[model samples]
Target chain A: MEKTINLTLKVWRQANATAKGAFESYEVKNISTDSSFLEMLDILNEQLINENKEPVAFDHDCREGICGMCSLYVNGRPHGPDDEVTTCQLHMRKFKDGETITIEPWRSAGFPVIKDLIVNRNAFDSIIAAGGYVSVGTGGVPDGNAMPIPKVDADEAMDAASCIGCGACVAACKNGSAMLFVSAKVSQLALLPQGKVEAARRAKNMVAKMDELGFGNCTNTGACEVECPKGVSIANIARLNREYLKAKCLD
Target chain B: MGTFFSSSIGKKFVMSLSGLFLVIFLLVHLSINALLLVPDGGEMFNNAAHFMALPLIKYGLQPVLFVGFIVHIFYATMLTSINNKARGSVKYAGGNNTKDVMWASKNMYVLGITVAAFMAVHLCDYWVPLQITGNVESTTLHGTEMHDTYALVNAAFSQCWRVALYVVGALGLSLHLTHGFWSAFQTLGASNSLWRKRWTVIGTIFAWVVGVSFSLIAILQHFFYQA
Candidate 1:
């Protein structure tokens, strides 16, 4: 027998932060358990469009769940109840029929609400802009493995580079903190020899840029890790601390 | 300050300094409170309280504690804000992401907010009342009224639910302070990677000892003294 489920969704809809926002309820029915959660949403949107209703707009790109684009808080959990899986990869089977799903965009002063189920995450870019890049251009002046990085450092750098910048850390944070995200970025560069030249400058500039963007402080709560699709370690935060201290002392 | 303040490294340095300061305060507080668990009862506890209440000590250390607490919270807020801002408009494709952090450390902000909320409660229960009333007054086991802070401490930690709440709150505090302690030292220039690793471990142990000692004393007193 084919299993079909019906669910209620109360999604946040706002033209922008300047505009008032409210939860609008919509019913999605006869959903296949095998269908991905986003597919279910696509079904709902299709229904709305057929009825000449404005569809709920959301941000997403690689439905494969590689891009950190699909940012949704389902029933108070970022990326829904599936542990470490983004909404795009979440199959409807994880949910039951007749369930109420509350969907909202990432909420943070830094990531402003852009529209219905969409938020502006440019604050991330600015932080990256602060010092995320190294001074490497088109033509490589050296071989790929020219700089011999230690195994441990290389491993740590790879781990840090795994950060997808999904903004889930911000959403899951009660204070809307971005410590996990920032730490990952810092750890990525701080561990590499190529990242050594401007290490001090990078840490200082990025941190300053983070504060200027209106994000909250890291209270040491681990909610970001729990909700993060990528399990970036809080240890990177410790590494970031060490880097910052060195930078400050040198300065 | 702004030049350093705005820098990522600068913020980490600030966070570490504040964290180290808090850790020192925790050790001192733990030692003092451990007196409450003494079988001699209120004599040792009251005397210690009295020493803390001395004019010079009270006026001087009290102000410093307040400043330390404020600076710790302020820097935490500033650091978190910067991380938030840097995330600006962008998204990622969800994939195989594994976290290296414990559940409690990542939620430090939430735990911190909880701790901060309780700080206000703690201050009101003891500090405000004592300051406003001019002094502590109550009956002791020996029928002496000598600055009986034991009574207030007893009343606060006795209620079943209140004790439970404190235990939970303390757990959060312990978890938070543990991570913050090592992380902070590393920020302030702890030797190299090897030394930093060792210190991180030491920091975690210290945090647990201090946190558990305070919470256990509260619970034990709630059982033994209250009865």
Candidate 2:
């Protein structure tokens, strides 16, 4: 059975980064229940284009959850009402027929809106550029088990590695803190034996860059953990704090 | 050091360190104040208060404690403003509830301001006259002359409104500590799962003990010990 939902979307419309933004209402009719949230936006854009009106501009690359490019503050959450899923994974079934969904950009000093619902997340890229990489030279492909690692450590590292840098943590945080994102990157490298060579430098440099980017301090509110689509834990934040403090003491 | 202190995490580290120091101070303060319950006509209380007033502590530790309080307040105000600005002008218009975060965690600033306001009243009642002016009516205790600090405390707590104020202050401290105790250790690098879980348990108990103990002294003095 094909089910459809008619939603009234109060989408934030901003022409440019410097322009004043406000919520503009549009009615999206006959949206399929199985359509992803982005797909619904696509339908609305198609309607606007057919009517010779300017379409809403949003950022999306792979349309898959892995890309971290699909950024939307659907309703109150970073990725709509769904848990442990990105906006691309959030289907229309989550909404009621007459629901009025509110959408906004990621509101943070580090992430200014480039246009309608499109935020400049280059701050994250800069932070990653700081020290998010291992210092190993490129050569022949190393053996998978060249470095022996405990299963617990490997699993923990993988968990930390799951962060997609979507900026959802900042969006969810009341303080707009990027600790969860920074901590995920820090912990992923800090936990693995291969990345352990420059763990201290990585921790210090990444934290410095994060601070330089004007992100707020973490107060351990744990909102970042709950609203995270990738299920990134604030435990990684604890590890980042540990790593940073250890590095500072040594310095 | 200046650059480090200016950083976001560095600011937080300052807050955590100062908060833990104040927590320790509270424990000592509570124990000293608990002497009010002693039924020896303020003899033991006065003597203990007199020792605390000795020059070594009166000049040395008092200044350090005051600086700790100032630093904590300074950094707290600075961080709160910066964090508020970092959230940007466009506020989240939707509902603001998350399952994992505590209410106290979100409202620590308000709790801190409440506690600070109470401290002003408390200092005016006791610290100013006793520490700064040394005008706290002297009395002899254990064959030595000491400020009748016990009388000051007993007289203050005897008033129902003053007892109510202390209770409110204790409540604010309890809420502040509930998130802060474990959070301080976490910021200081206690990140392991086992230790984090343990700290959460320990932090809650610590908050409860401090709050209940401080409030008990006030309530007890108000109803039972009117001397």
Candidate 3:
């Protein structure tokens, strides 16, 4: 067995919004292929901190793939070479020794770089803010199954709700469009009986907010689905379009 | 403006119409380019090229194609921007690890942008040079500078690397089309009880044929053509 393998990493280093950025190479020695991709980065950051160099700042909350915060574009692919996992879940086993991995932040006008590996995904919040929530007042004591939605609708709603809002769809998009995310959110709620009261308004507000955030349009490239961890259907986008059209034309 | 635009169906209707229009253009383009493979004497290719370049056709139809291109791009841009603003500051967890949605649809915008970028490159390679500079220094078919515009077509596609680029661009276009085609129809009211699954399959096949056919012509000509 080979005891040690060398790797070259070209990580993006931007001190702040005002500073120009460039790629800095670092050598990682003797890494086990079994190590998670983030674990490899942790090893690198530990080495940097020990050497008194400021560690590379990346956004990661849960080391598991559940949190969308661990955003990184590995070798021109959002979230490494693997098909559907987040950067945190990507294992080094997928890569060969001595491979040069190019790591960069999400490139989108809407997703501005906050620092190394951190992007302000506020664009997502605004879309939800636009109409993501149901308009029920507080202190509701309704039963869990008050309204009986169709089984198919319930199942589909569950599917749409599975979207974790990880900006992978945005990062993966060439035009930086967020239709997948917005549509998923809109469809999930709109599918439910509880969400009926404001379905039209919800679709309109969310879509408009999406447009305002500078994300590129969706031309159905499907790269988002190829990269989406949640497997959100492009059908949701169709649903979103339907909802938006209906809401728009009724007046 | 704000009132109706705020509805879900309204957006879907526009997106669907625009998408259908673009799909029609793709079919037309694919059929036209497929003429290059018609075989024997290059008669079909010339006729098709001449048909397209006729003074009436060029003058009368160029403006319409231009408008189609603009509307397709414009609505796509507008819808995307609105979604971004609406979903501000939240991200869904799951990476290549996410087990739910298909990766292709999630990254539609990315693929679209790639196709658009490559389209620009392709247009420059063929359309601009051939149309703007009519001196025709590239490839000449028999004696007359490949009049029938055959010279320009061969010139742009004959190179090995350029052929490779065309293949890659076609891949991007295919990826975009496969997901977008039926999806747009679905949004426009085709998501009925019977035709949804059928259209999805048809859309995928359509994407492959158009994309591969357009790209295959370039590759075959570069590798196997005897001229």
Judging by TM-score against the true structure, name the best candidate: 2
lDDT of 2 at A25: 94
B1-227 per-residue lDDT for model 1 (tens digits): 55766555565566667677777877777888888888775678887776787888788887887888898788777665555554344332221132444656555667789888877877888887666675567545446445678777878888888778777777778888777776565455454447657876887888787778878988898889874
Over B149-182, each residue of candidate 3 has an lDDT whose tens digit, in order, gives 5556766677778888889989888888777877
DockQ, each predicted model: 0.20, 0.66, 0.11
Q: lDDT at B205 for candidate 2? A: 95
Error of 2 at B80 (Å): 1.5
Pairs in steric clash, model 2 = none
Model 3: CAPRI class: incorrect
**CAPRI tier for the interface of model 2:** medium
Which segments of model 3 are wrong by more than 4 Å? A1-4, A137-146, B1-183, B186-197, B203-227
Residue A98 of model 2, lDDT score: 97
Highest-lDDT candidate: 2
lDDT of 2 by residue, A157-249 (tens): 999999999999999998889999999999998998768889889988999998888888889988999999899988888899888888887
Which scores higher on lDDT, 2 or 3? 2
Candidate 1's C-alpha runs over 4 A off are: A137-145, B5-19, B29-227
TM-score of chain A of each: 0.94, 0.97, 0.94
Top candidate on DockQ is 2
